[model samples]
Target chain A: MKISKEEVEHIAKLARLEIDEKEKERFAHQLSDVLNHMEKLDQLDTEYVEPTSHILPIHNVFKGDEIKEVFPMADPLSNAPQKDHGHYRVPKIVE
Target chain B: MDYEAIIGLEVHTQLLTKSKIFCSCSTQFGAKPNQHTCPICLGMPGVLPVLNRDVVEFTIRTALATNCRIAPSNRFARKNYFYPDLPKGYQISQYELPLAMDGYIEIGSNETKKRIGITRIHMEEDAGKLIHGENLGHPDSSYVDFNRTGVPLMEIVSEPDIRAPEEAREYLLKLKAILEYIEVCDCNMEEGNLRCDANISVRPEGRREFGVKAELKNMNSFKNVQRALEYEIKRQVQTLEKGEEIVQETRLWDVNSERTISMRSKEEAHDYRYFPEPDLVPTVISEDWIEDVRSKLPELPDAKKERFVREYGIPEYDAGVLTSSRSLADYYEACVRLFPNPKIISNWVMGDILRELKDDERGISECPITPGHLTGMLRMIEDGRISGKIAKIVFEEMYRSGKMPDEVVKEKGLVQISDEGELLIFVDRVIEENPDMVEAYQKGKTKLFGYFIGEVMKASKGKANPALVNKFLKDRLDCNV
Candidate 1:
């Protein structure tokens, strides 16, 4: 397989995902298959093709710098799992 | 073997925008927690991020000022990371195609001027503030304030051309001055309006290849940037000398400990996984837009400094000091309009005015003495209305009470004693009181001439015209009149 088990584990850790050993094995095989299918594009000889950044022809979408009223929704931190003092509280992440 | 340090700086300065970059929320500092966040900045589902029009204009202004080539087209990208400060799982920034590239700012200490290459200047969104500990009585959890989140930032990356820590400082100072002159950033380091991080490496003096490097962060001031680089370079040199490889890592400048400490190792670091932002459209810049930004750019520091020297005939050093800040240059020019003596005005501004402001740690804008008062005081010296010594006293009282120079001089009786008859009375008293000095002066003790002058100046309470006193004393003492 192009994607090793350790590589799959590393990728999962970077995304902060939790998976058991069986799920890791399955993801390794699945990711390698997806990459192998994507590799078929390498056979195309289209060196002159212009790389595409956006599919749409639109550009320069900007809003004026003037301040407008903020969209009033429910309290911003109301849905947090833990909140205090008008702040969204998370686990301690000090340096 | 002597080791040379190679340093590169990544300076992030917050732009002075009326609203946040991607949203319409007010970008005011010190707002309530999460007060400035909207659905877009907070990364809510189904929300799209739109660019602020002024951010692009301001970025173009800086790019032109730094001689950077603005990209014909640019787009935002997502820098994926996980931190409490970043509400979104990824930060919207420019990755491969930044707005501008290949700029340079000149820095010099002494007479040696050098160009420090600016690699890129890209626009990005700032992260929120993370509060740890029980500072706000949230003891058990870390709190995040999104007030600063999504505020526009321009990250200027420098080429790895800095050879020393002091050069790094010079580069930051020049960049800060340029940004301020262009009226783009406030350039206030204390309030987090401007931030800097540096990456440094050390190699033997004549070696070509670079050594392992450590990234330094959390330097709150420019002085701290230089100090941190110095400490890290020394540490790396020692590590290399001890036959140990310098570990590649990120370090934090511990303020209290006065040294750089390891913040994270390479093994624990995760890739940013940058990808083009799908929600935002690419920004295309035409020649007209660049020209429009170029035309509106203000007079930068170097050009203004040169003009000061050429037009005002002041020394290069004096012009450099006067044009250090835009307001200060304006102050000097205003005084010159009224007084028309550049060297004299430069002396007062650089010596007395700057000293007074520095003691209180204030900018020239906050100074109480106006240009009218300054030129008014200087005019007294020119018009023979007050002595130079007394003008110093008048200037202080004027600054303290925010009074005009004429009012201060009148209230304190600080006018010059220039009249010949008014001077003769004090002169006669001095010669009478010191008969030995007078006789000795008649016997060719010409050195005692200064003694007579001192006594007369004291009797007149330091308001005597020195030129008149000299003429009167020479006539009286040389012939025993």
Candidate 2:
């Protein structure tokens, strides 16, 4: 499972990350090494065992469907990079 | 060349819980922009989310309604994507193992009943709404409203079993009805509580393999969904007919142009990279809880329709129409309970009541006439207090004024003319004014009896009891005097 430079660039575009030309090569190698190391676990044959999704055995943690106090506009809007009419503003997106 | 279309739908229905899926923010629609936001829903760092118990119960209710097998233990995963509306840059959804799977919904009516397989139903959180316009006081910019950011959604995926666009529409209708029947979702398309995305493909006739598929979005109503699929099917068949390979892509249905346009090609598809969420714990549902929810389930449409035919003695078609909505069925039953004449009640409900409601574009919940008022008018006709024609006028007045039928009848002086003395004057005048018709009737032209009845009814202004008028006219016209 070797990762190519072109594949790395494609993934970066999908993630909306801005990567320079030189960094693409280095990151591709690093990510490929990480993936290869994780592949070693596939050697074990444990077909009868059930897959685990969580490390802890805790389950069914929930709260009642009741409304609590909500934060005012000042709480979230204060952290926004650009705010307009009490909403978060971003670059125009078509489609 | 004849080609067959294979269609499947993915529906996202917003649950009608009081709070958000993972937070305590109110999940009400159309609130002021960002008025329902909190640190948890806003995706602030170091903020943790607690699951709402109602969301899980609602999901289980939906699964049981659709005949799905629930997973004893299910967990949520993070679907990685990048969009401005997604403040967390990822949506928490289910993957690999979902809440329910391998369920089926029976669609169509009568001889066309077909079972469409549902692949899975999973829980997820909704993204914020994006408002793009120049009127936001900033040209060439987009505004985001986080009021709907963390609303709970159930993604129901169906297998590709639909053979035509019409079947696809029927499948959606049945699915929506079931969701509303259980009161899990409001199923309002206008309010964005329910949305659908379709996957469509066309292959040569008698071929077992499927052709390249295209995903369609942006259909705001069920009618649009059918029209879009119809257009996409034709487009795919024409492309294949021209010896061109079909390109896999995602298309948006343009309502004004009535055509599907490509939004993104398969090359730009996202990987998603789903992984289990560590913030929330997995849900372990016990058998006792499942049985409890099952016992509390309401009578579904199919069972209710069957009972209406057996118990109420109404035809299957009338039962189908009456039981289409829960509120409408309740209204029909209430009228039947009071009137105790199933066929007559069915006629009034299916005929005049439905016609007036359709004209006004209103649903049964917004109907002006209550069950008691409607039965009151029927009782007037039954007891000979008002003629059938006069009852119609009373019904119209009651609908317009929201008054009781008795009140409308009394105010308009619409009592039937069943008394012999009151009707005798109009009957005598009608016989005397038409001497030629009277001679014809004496000459044994028996069909002229209808003409006399018409003349008498006209003179009485349609307030005469038809049965009494028939008897009175026959007795008078038969006499020599």
Candidate 3:
């Protein structure tokens, strides 16, 4: 149940995180410990239990298709670090 | 070596819902940039995403129309990717469980009906529009429009059942027509309401295994989709012939170049770590609810097309062209109700009306000439008030000026002259002028009869009743001979 260092590095890259070599090794060890502990639950046999993505008892929460109050464009643009006429500006993504 | 292309299509159509999928922001297009966005859609911290009830209902309608099996329970997953268009680090999409599955859309290709298997239809939130700085004179940065963010989209994925590029276009068109019939998506590709991507691979003829596949993007129109797939298949086959492997990557259809250019990124780089969304709960649809949605489904394109052929007795091709849109089909049916000759209505609609609409890139709903106006003009032709040729001119005027058929005919003075007394003058003038043609007709050059009819028609400015002109010209020419 040991996570490889390469696996940790790949995970970091997918999350857009830049980690040093030492951090990659440390993360691999720590993540493996966490997964191994979670894997210990395999001892329990609840064959009839329905696997669920969320443990919450609630389901099917929906809002009607009614338009609420319209918010001003300036509010969100003000929070942006860089904006151009109510549009959020970011580095161009060519590809 | 010959290669057969195995193409699969992925289509994303924006649902015609009033509100955004997770927020109450208006889903109206062409608003000011970022005007329709809210905190939830902007991915602000500490906001719960609520599904819109209309989105699922629309999904049920679409799934039923496509003959898909609706999933009793489904949940949304977060697809993690970093792009400026997506305000959230991940897009909220369905991963493990989709809304519906195992559908087949039957399309007419090469005079045969082929059923393309639909793999799945999943609901997801649309990303925002990114206006690249280079295109807008702001060279280093891009502007983002969040107005399109959080728009509900149904991603319909088809199985690799399409064997040719033409079949792919047929499949896409059939799907668009179905969406239009259900009134779920606008299916306007130019406005980005309906977008398509294709996955194409070529294998040696009769090979059991599949060749490497490339994903094609940015095909904004159905024509471009077929062109892009054709170009991609050629590129792959050429690579295989050169003993070079076809690279597995995403390529974009360049409309200007008329070929697909490699996007220079491999699929491995876009590792979307998908996980179930914690905020939004699973949707569990009941049998009664599914039945209710199914009962509300409109008559889809295929059924309507078949009925048009059987009920109206029009050609299958005419029925297809007319039934391409729901409103157009309704227009045809309304015209038929007013005028019992369905074949004639089909000819006028498919020939003249659609030609005008296609030229202007307009829809039937936007047509100035309604079914009433069309049927009114057809009655004029039936009664010989206007000849068929003159009716075309009158119809054009009615379409252009949005006037009634009578008004156009009156304003343009396009009444057919069925009075033999009035047409006899033009007939005698033509026979008197064409002495050589007259002598030729007497000398058994009877093909000159068409020449006499033509001269009279020309002199009358195409207003003479063709039948009367023929009868009068024959009598004038024969009696003189």
What tens-digit string does per-residue lDDT give for candidate 1 at B296-413? 8889989999899899998888888888889999999999999998889999999999999999998999989999999999899888888888888998998899999989988888
Clashing pairs in 1: none
Measured over all alpha carbons after superposition, the RMSD of each candidate to the real structure, in angstroms, is: 1.5, 1.7, 2.1
Which window of ten consecutive residues has the lowest lDDT sum in model 1 chain A? A69-78
Off by over 4 Å in 2: A39-50, A70-73, B265-269
In model 1 chain B, the worst 10-residue window by lDDT is: B262-271
lDDT of 3 at B128: 91
Relative to the real complex, the DockQ score for model 3 comes to 0.69
Give per-residue CA lDDT, model 1, range A1-95, as digits (tens): 39989988888888999999999999999999999999999899879987776899899999999888768956888777888888888887756
How high is each candidate's interface RMSD, in Å?
A: 1.6, 2.1, 1.9
Candidate 1: which docking quality band? medium
* Candidate number of the best DockQ: 1
Clash count, one per candidate: 0, 0, 0
- Cα deviation at B4, candidate 2, in Å, is 1.6
Error of 1 at B96 (Å): 0.5
* DockQ of every candidate structure: 0.74, 0.68, 0.69
Give Cα distance to truth, residue B87, candidate 1, Å.
Answer: 1.3
* lDDT, candidate 2, B1-481, per-residue tens: 7899999899999999999999999998878889899989889889888888988999999999989999998989999887889989899999987999999999766677789999999999999999885869677889999999999999999999999999998888888888988999988876789999999999989999999999999998999999999999989989998899988888999999999999774446468888989898999899999999999999998889889999999998899889888889999999999999999999999999999999998998888999999999999999999988888899899889999998998898888899999888888889899999989888978899999888888888888888988988888888764
